[model samples]
Target: MFKQKYGTTALVAGASEGMGAAYAHALASRGMNLVLIARRKEELEATAADIATRYGVKVLPVVCDLAAPDATQQIIHVIGDTAIDFLVYNAALSFIGPYLSTGPSTHLDIAAVNVQTPLALLHYFGGKMVARRRGGIVMMASLAGFQGSGFLATYGASKAFDRVLAEGLWYEWKPFGVDVIACCAGATATPNYNNTHPRKGSFLEPKAQLPAQVVEECLQKIGTVPSFVSGTGNKLVSFLLSHVLPRKKTVKIMGDSMHKIYGSKWESN
Candidate 1:
């Protein structure tokens, strides 16, 4: 049923490893050919080869930096006429510190990766889907997007943009037979998240989810809702942060969590 609806081929950005790789494997398990994009050549090709061997589906690995201005064009060139029935934008760039700590260049790169590329891809592939009258899109948003996160301010803002964009597109494209969803994921045990080396025994540490679990929930809920928080705990937390608490309190709570995890001077990409 999953494959029949959004099968044949899928394109996943930032698919070299972690949650992106999980998304690739899940789609391939459903018998979909894959076009995997990421910046790491060795990792991307290795992931593609492994998926092809394990699932017996065509896997094309394209090593392209999502922050590059011509990233969407590069992907389109590699994909040629392959109609991507499902598109997943999972690539992101984050600087985990005070916003002003990073220079303008770093913030610009984050905007490029987290915002520009996804919007460009959506416009290109989504237009094709609308014409064909069938397809799906998954934009990887974050729980941080629900409000102003202290340390991860820029990244959270970009994700908020994605969440709202996906919801609006969901409504606009529903009648055209295209499904758009923003997977508002919580803290998952991805390589990047682990690299941050978050301190033990924090309020949210124990609640951290695995990559496979997050991707599984995302796939299951894509066509069902315009946007959804991946984990049950995340869902509850999202509600409390967005609906139950006052804005200042919610922001303070998130800020304190970040302080606990990364302290004042740490950074991670």
Candidate 2:
């Protein structure tokens, strides 16, 4: 059965809504006090209030743009001396389009939010966890991380970095009683997913999971494994990609699926 294996205080980045919020709910239900971080103060406060009231656990909401240059510093300052037993690095930004056509600023923003912020948190908080000999880290990754995605080049690469980093950290920290996990999710029901791929049965659409399902699965596996794909369908698909398909075939299939979803929007050059 599931258990609360980490410390009392848990911090969740991108906790304003979607999967991040779901993670907060799961943790709070497991009796962990929350430190919620997100760009939207109102949304963050609302989520914090609801969770605090429902689970009877204290919730602190910190507003910060994770892509900002000093976001990690600001977050650390707000956290003060509280020991974060579990850290969920869930914030991410992706400018979905052909890589070359996207502006450099947007690309940098993606890198900052998806890569730099997580790295900073893991380095700082993870070090503390290692010293104390107990804690857990969950990095939100995606199926795109496993292969070269055509339209989502930057996003895919960034997720790949997250997945690899989480795995390496997991290996390193486990011996010291720290648990690190990469939650590689497939298409889930989110505002971003709905807006981007409006049609059904397109690539990841067929097996779309709920945010709650992903969070529950992630929580169950966090302390036990280095990584987990959120949904059953996603796990099966990941296994096939890993064991059955060659890299060329896998990349082609993923690229073709992406083209079907995004090709209509691109202007002919």
Candidate 3:
């Protein structure tokens, strides 16, 4: 059922490694051909080759920076007339320190990668999906988006946009046979996450999930809900933050956790 509905070809942005690569592999395993996009050429091509070999499905690797102004056009140009049945927008930029420490350009770039590009791509591909009357979209959101995270302020705000966008689109597009979902993942063992060097024994480290686990859970829940926090622990935490706790308390909890993880690297503006 999954393959038949969304199996023709899937496009995974930021598919060079980590969760994006995992999404690509999962879709390929389900018999979907793929068009993988990322900034790193070698890594992207290597991932595409490996998936094609392992799953015996067509894989096209397109190297393009999602932060670029013309990212959506670049992807569309590369894919040509090939129809994309599913889209996984996984590209994101984050700054994990005092928000004011970074220059305005850095925050703008984060907004571009995390919010603007995804919105543009959704408008492009989502329209096609609605027209075809069959498709799916998975926008990678984050648990931090639930509140005003201290260090990840801008990134969280951008993800909040994605989460709401997906929810609204899910409602508007479902009638047209298109399934849109936002996978609000918690801490996962992705390269980008690991690069942050989260403090060991911190509250988030113990709860960190594997990329494959995150991707699998996301795939399972895509057509069932507009959005979901991936993982059992994450669900519990999300529930507490959103329902049980007050908004002020929720923001403080996230702020404290982020401070614990990246406080050492914090710089004064």
TM-score of each: 0.96, 0.94, 0.96
Write model 2 residue lDDT over 151-235, tens digit each, in one string. Answer: 8888999999999999999999999999999999988887667778644435444468999998888887877888888787888
Q: Arrange candidates by lDDT, descending.
A: 1, 3, 2
Q: Assess the local accuracy of residue 7 in candidate 1 as a C-alpha lDDT between 0 and 100.
A: 57
- Regions of model 1 farther than 4 Å from truth: 200-206, 264-269
- Per-residue error at 47 for model 1, in Å? 0.4
Model 3 weakest lDDT span, ten residues long: 198-207
RMSD of each: 1.9, 1.9, 1.6
lDDT of each: 0.91, 0.88, 0.90
Q: Residue 233: error of model 3 in Å?
A: 0.6
* TM-score between model 2 and native: 0.94
Expressed as tens digits, the lDDT of each residue in 46-158 for candidate 3 is 99999999999999999999899999999889889999999999999998888788799999999999999998999999999999999999999998898898888999999
Residue pairs in clash, model 1: none
Backbone clash pairs for candidate 3 read none
